[model samples]
Target: MASFQIIIIGTGIAGLATAISLSQKTQHQILILESSSVLTEAGAGIQCSAAASRVLSSWALREEFEAVATCPDFTEIRRYEDDELIGLIPANVNDYSTRLRGFPHWLVHRVDYQKILADAATTRGVKIDFGQKVVAIDVDNVEVTLASGRSLRADLIIGADGIHSRTRRSIPALKDVVPRRTENYCYRALIPREEMLKNPVTATLIDNQSQQAWAGQFKHIISYPIAKGKFYNLVMTVPDHGDAPLGQYNEPGDVSEMRQVFKDFNETVQAVLDTIDSCAKWVLADLPPLPTWSSPNGRVILVGDACHAMAPHAASGAATSLEDAEVLGLCIATCNGIADLPRAAKDYEHLRRPRCERIQEISRENATTFALPDGPMQEARDQIWRAQKAMLEKQLQEDTPLAIPAEDMAQQFPHPALVQWLVGHDIIEEARTHLATRKEIHNIL
Candidate 1:
């Protein structure tokens, strides 16, 4: 294998994970360029589905991850008005073992997850340069110009700088591609477990280490325990009322307005809100699937939010980013020399684009489903959840396998098949198979 220099822009989850993956799988010198002077303790909660867990497991960060993460037993969807249980998605490892083969769903603080990835990447010999803002990219020459007026040349440049990526803008083909506002804003808060334990109504939430989503008209709330159950993460998504400009991602939220918006919600929800002294409001936005995720020369490629940003409804954004890193690493590791880099980049995009596009669509669809108004559509959606819940209860009571209609199961949020496709997928194996087929075809030609 030929030794090559690979520069990854940004040190977010995607960038760090890519560095770690590449360092582990290939002999390339992986360098990460972070625009920030130092990594700040920012971000709220992130739900890591089995798909991401699989990737993390391969990176040998399970012990480190589990130390700071919470493994939710299950995720429950409930009615916002009365707190009625609408549906349940089992997330216990024991349940997954019998179903999806032991991959677990994790609730983690984003800061903790990033630290783990950063540590792992550094431990594997990946060098990270801070305050290196990439201002321009010369794809033909495989070079990136930093804001400091210095230029660095590499065999490959990965634009993982995120939604407002300068590297992405430098690509002529992606000049018109931009992030579209979803017209939804979210309030994020973290409540100490000690506060929640003081109230009997809220105490039950922390008892089982389960995730809960309160679904209602034009809004929804998803909450889970993170930081090893020391704090509870809460995110309230509502219709955007133009409180903040699209350019500003996070801002101070008005606690009074937040409480008023959900005042009609059940007592349990109010109890959770009462504990919030302050919160951050984030405007939710995502990019449309680009015409392509790579430059025409294939030397500059986009990963994670830079290429396929999506709404948080599906909780697969981070997971998909991890999948990108895993697949891209596997694809690049197949190259025997610099001449194979372009083909490797093309293979990575071909293997990743469709899945990412589909997940983006699903996430938008989920936003609609989660905020359906009180009407026949909402009623029908609720009915589907009720039927599924009843079926599961009966199956548990009888200890027998009952026929579950595919259509009915498909209507449930986070549909079983979708979960299987997202979580049960083996990206590494898929990438290897893809590379092998391409090699065989090339030989035949």
Candidate 2:
């Protein structure tokens, strides 16, 4: 029998989710390597959309999230100038029972989510090794060389490293791929729930279970409850085209500048801004949709930001990565621990490239609309978003920006239902037909 061990680089949600999803399906051994001497995560919060929650709920994390996560009862998008509630995003039964169980978003601490994912992976028999940096991946032999000079040979290698993934750049096939920085800077702050509740402007049920997203001419801010209602997390987006590589938090940010970013706004927003502590700025960056993330050889491939990275427009980056994990796992489940590995990698890219590319486009488009200048475009967009709210609430088919034929979209994500089906049903014939004209591009020698 061929060896069936899988090696994963990184320990974030993407890495753990892959190990967990694949552990139950095959007898394959799984190893996850993280570079940190100890766990170190960004000081921020992550919002799990309905689609993302759907994947997690199926993984049986629904109750755990409910216990520690602050469920948002409503999602409100408002205008920056006057703070008029643009429209409300409703959380209904289908969204609830299958995904978040009724909440559109969950305000979760980064550390909390990481712990839960790590624990889940361990329970599934995944061997996790910390403090090992993956310096090189020999796709030809399915081996990985760590920074410490340890050699690891596996049936497959998954690079879940972040935006500046060393494994991605190491692959000659992905040599020309470049990550693009969006013309936006994200600033975040965390405050005690009691402090926010004490502010008269946000004192009202703002302390309750709900999320607030406000759009302005050139900036945006998101605030929601977190830490089991003990603290609140806020992230504000401001326009900045300056040169910065995801700047670190060291020098303090001017409070005036932070306030001015949303000065023409609501009293509640103004009040919240007054409480921000400095040293916050993340230059948003994303990779263009690649036709393939697989390597020139079949034994190695990229996952998470190492592959189809998207802007945090819909908070879909991690969600999509987890999806990629599941599908990749399914492909490897067929591995007989032999030379069948090449065929498995080819099939994996064939099934994934189209979908990840589609999601990449959707995520980019969302960024454009969200940052639309204040003018006719904004007016038209407001109308469209309101309609989306209605459709999502009334069970009507959402009217898309353009009428794309179902066949065309089939190359990637054809519909929201497909996302759910990716976790459930997939007809093999459709996949075979789709990749019919496709050759083994990733493994093309």
| Top TM-score hit | 1
Residues 328-380 of candidate 2: C-alpha lDDT, one tens digit per residue? 66666665555666676777777777766766676666566666788998898
State every prediction's TM-score relative to the real structure: 0.94, 0.84
Model 1 scores a TM of 0.94
CA shift at 117, candidate 1, in angstroms? Answer: 0.4
Model 1 agreement with the true structure over 1-445: per-residue lDDT tens digits:
5678999999988899899988988888989999899875456889988789888998898888888888886788999999999987767624542355346778899999988999899999999999888888888888999899999999889988887887888788888777888869899999888998999988888665889999988999999988887888998999987757885666889999999999888999999999988899888989988888888777788899999989999898889999999998887777777777778788889999988988888888888888899999999988877776676666666755433323221333566666667666777778777777873333210
Clashes per candidate (backbone, < 3 Å): 0, 3
Worst lDDT run of 10 residues, candidate 2, spans 399-408
